[model samples]
Target: MIVAEHLTKRFGQKQAVSDVSFTVAPGKVTGFLGPNGAGKSTTMRMIVGLDRPTSGSVSIDGRSYSSLRSPLTEVGVLLDAKAVHTGRSAVNHLRSMAATHGIRRSRVDEVIEITGLTSVARKRAGGFSLGMGQRLGIAAALLGDPHTLILDEPVNGLDPEGVMWVRRFVRHAASEGRAVLLSSHLMSEMALTADHLIILGRGRVLADAPLADIVEQWTTKSVRVRSPRAREIAEAAASDTVSVTSRGNGYLDINGATAAEIGELAAARSLPLHELTPTTGTLEDAYLKLTGDQVEYKTKEVR
Candidate 1:
């Protein structure tokens, strides 16, 4: 398991992370989410000892990453896919990494096959596409079969098949009692893959909770209704606990009321209903709401 206690980092006058504390337990995938400059990468770098924290501590299985006698055997990291040697072949690159930790060539071949890079094993890394580069990076990370994995944007530039593979692979690793810390921009995929989430904004943790809890707390379920008498139906549905909003044309967005309730009300009023659909809150909805005020940069609309 990975544990961070009041983890803070600073770069000269700027604070990159502040008093961040969380546990990435074994047997689960913990997603690290944030805006563009929300300090997600900085924290991950600190966790792996690439950047020292200005204060506080981070440990893997009761030992700091820098103090691990065999770091590769204890933790696997894929912070940057392009950090490899551009002039080396994929096979040679893996070989060099394996040599650092006394890992065998057979294990390298195993990861190459597992990551679907066997065909491109002899190709120079500089010639590989973005997807191939990501695969190679994953292969390197898995070379030692570490008990803990830290991946940043593991599915970037991947095809649908590759993305699904990563989802399944990470879950399988967690099932085997590995600690998994993942970061990604794809909210849909994160919803499907992560069991827990650590949300950061402007160098501080905004939320650290289960996926379901975050979605339920940050967004509300709503019912969508379309009718010629939408205004009328909305008037009838509106109450102390429910809110109805016009969504243009003959559509109404009703919150705090179920589809059944709205349908029954419309039926009792003899109102003609074209459509009545219930929609649940999604991860994207919750993420946008949680980070709405924490965005570091705003893009103005082109009028």
Candidate 2:
């Protein structure tokens, strides 16, 4: 397990992270989410002792990462795929890292096969493509077979199959009772992979809860209706309390009202209804809603 209490960091005049506190527990995949400049990288760096915290503490299991005699065996991390020695072959690079903690050569071969890097194992890392670099990074992280894993943008340059492999790898790791803290920009993949979430914005913790709870809490309940008289039904249902959105094509979404309420309203108005179904927002919807005000960069138009 990983525990962070009152973790904070600052670079010169800019505050990167502020009084953040959360736990990445065993047997679960806790997703880390944030917009650019949200301080996620700094926090992960502090966890692995790469950067010093301005205040507060972070520990692996029950001890600080620096205090561990065998840090590799305790925790594995993949913060950057391009951090490896560019001139070294993939095999040589893994060998050097494995040698740090006396990991055997068989394990090196194992991880090479596991990450599907055997084809390019003897190739210079500098020559590897972005997707291949990501695979190499993952192989290094798993070399120790540590009890905990911390990965940042593990699927950034991966193909569809590579992405699926990561999803399966993290899910399988968590299933084996390993603590996994993952950060990614792919909301759809995160929704499918994470059991819990820790969302950060502007360098502070905005949300720490189960995936379902975060989605449910940030999103309002809404219902979908299909009918030729959708505009009419929506107009009839609209009031000071109810909200309606016309999607065109005889489809509309109604909020602040239940499906039964809308159905009854349509029936009373004598509007022929083709469909009336209750629906909830997806993870992406909930994330956008939760971080709408917290976005650091805004586009001129979504289109």
Candidate 3:
């Protein structure tokens, strides 16, 4: 397990991260989500001891990363796919990393085969595509067979197949009782990949809960109705139980009203309905709603 307790970091006058505390447990895929410049990278760097925190502390199991006797064997991290030496072959890179803790070459070969990079193990890393580079980084992370994995944007440049492979790999690692902390900006991907979510905004945590719970907290179920008699329907359903809004497309968006309730009302009024679609907001919508105000930048249309 990885635990971050009141972790805070500051660079000069700007605070990059602030009082962020969370636990990433074994046997579950925990997603760390945030918008650009939301302190995600900074927090990860601090956790791995790449950056010194101004205050607070982060620990792997029960010890700080700096205190680990065999750091590589205790935690595996793929912070940047481009951190590898461009001129080095994939095998050479993994070999070098494994050699750090007296790990054998056989383990390096095993990771190469596991990551499906054996075919191009001899190729220069600089010449490889983004997807291949990501795969190589993952291979290096698995080289130590660590009990904890920290991956940042693992699927950033992956093809659909590669993306699926990463999703399965993370899930498999967690299932084997490894602590997995995955950071990504892709809400749809997180919705599918993560069992729990840690949402960050402006260097602070906005929500940390089960993925389903966070979604439920931020989104509401609604119904979309399109009819020639939209005005009449709106008038009849404008009670406190339902809130109606114009869809700006000759339709009405109704919240807090179920399909059955709307259908029954329409039937009683003898209103001619063209469409009645039940709509539930997705994780993306929920995320947007939660972090809309905390975003660092916004683009406004010019007049």
Candidate 4:
């Protein structure tokens, strides 16, 4: 388990992270999400003792990372896959990392096979592709068989098959009671892999809740309606409490009303409805709504 209490970070005059607090417990995958420069990377660095927090504290399993007697066996980290030595082979790199902790050579080979690097185990690190580099980083992280895993964009350069493998592997690790903290820009993947979410915006904790609760609290569920008289239905559904938008081509998106409500309104108005489908709130929708005001950079409308 990882606990962060009132964590804050500063770079000269600017504050990168401000009084953020969250817990990543064992047996569940917790996703850390944020927009560009929202301090997600900075916070992760502090957790692993790479960067110092200006205030407050972070601990893994009730002990600070620096205080851990065997840091590798206690927490696994993959902050930067490209930070490896270019001269060493994949197998040699893992072996060197293992040697520092007195890990057996068998364990080094185990991670290489586990990460599917057996084919290129002897290849120089600089010669590997982005996907291969990510695999090597994961291999090194697993070399220690740590109880807690912290990964940042583990699927960044992976193929679809590699992505699915990571999803399953993280879930399986959590099932074995390991604490898993993951960060990713891919909302769809997070929706599938994460049991809980910790959202950051402008260096502050915007939300910390279960995936379902965050979606329910921040997003408005919508209903999709298809009909020949789409404009008429939309006009009728528009109200102070309801919102309706035309999608063109005989489709309307309705919010603040359920499928049953839409169907009843269509029936009462004698408007034949071909489809009335309710869409559950998605993680992307909730994230955008909550961080809409917090985004530091905004794109101008083309028009």
Model 3 over residues 1-303: C-alpha lDDT tens digits?
989999999999999899999999999999999888889999999989999999999999988889998888889999999999999999998899888899999999998898889889999999999999999989988888999999999998999998999999999999999999999888888889999999999999999999999888899989999998999999998898899999766699999889889989999999988999998788899899999999898779799
Worst 10 residues of 2 by lDDT: 294-303
**lDDT digits (tens) for residues 11-119 of candidate 4:** 9998999999999999999999999889999999999899999999999999999999888888989999998999999999999999999999999999999999999
Clashing pairs in 4: none
Q: For model 1, how does the per-residue alpha-carbon lDDT over 249-303 read when each residue is reduced to its tens digit?
A: 9999999999999989999999999999998899999999999999998899899
lDDT of 2 by residue, 1-303 (tens): 999999999899989999999999999999999988889999999999999999999999989999999887889899999999999999999999989899998999999999999999999999999999999999998999999999999999999999999999999999999999999999999999999999999999989999999999988889999998778898898999999999999999889999999989888878999999999888898888878898888778866
Q: What is the number of residue pairs that collide in model 1? A: 0
Distance (Å) between predicted and true CA of 51, model 4? 1.2
Candidate 4: worst-modelled 10 consecutive residues by lDDT:
290-299
**What clash pairs does model 3 have?**
none
Q: Give the whole-model CA lDDT for all candidates, comma-separated.
A: 0.95, 0.94, 0.92, 0.95
Best by lDDT: 1
lDDT of 2: 0.94
lDDT-wise, the better of 1 and 3 is: 1
Could you tell me the lDDT of residue 191 within candidate 1? 97
* Candidate 4: stretches off by over 4 Å: 297-303
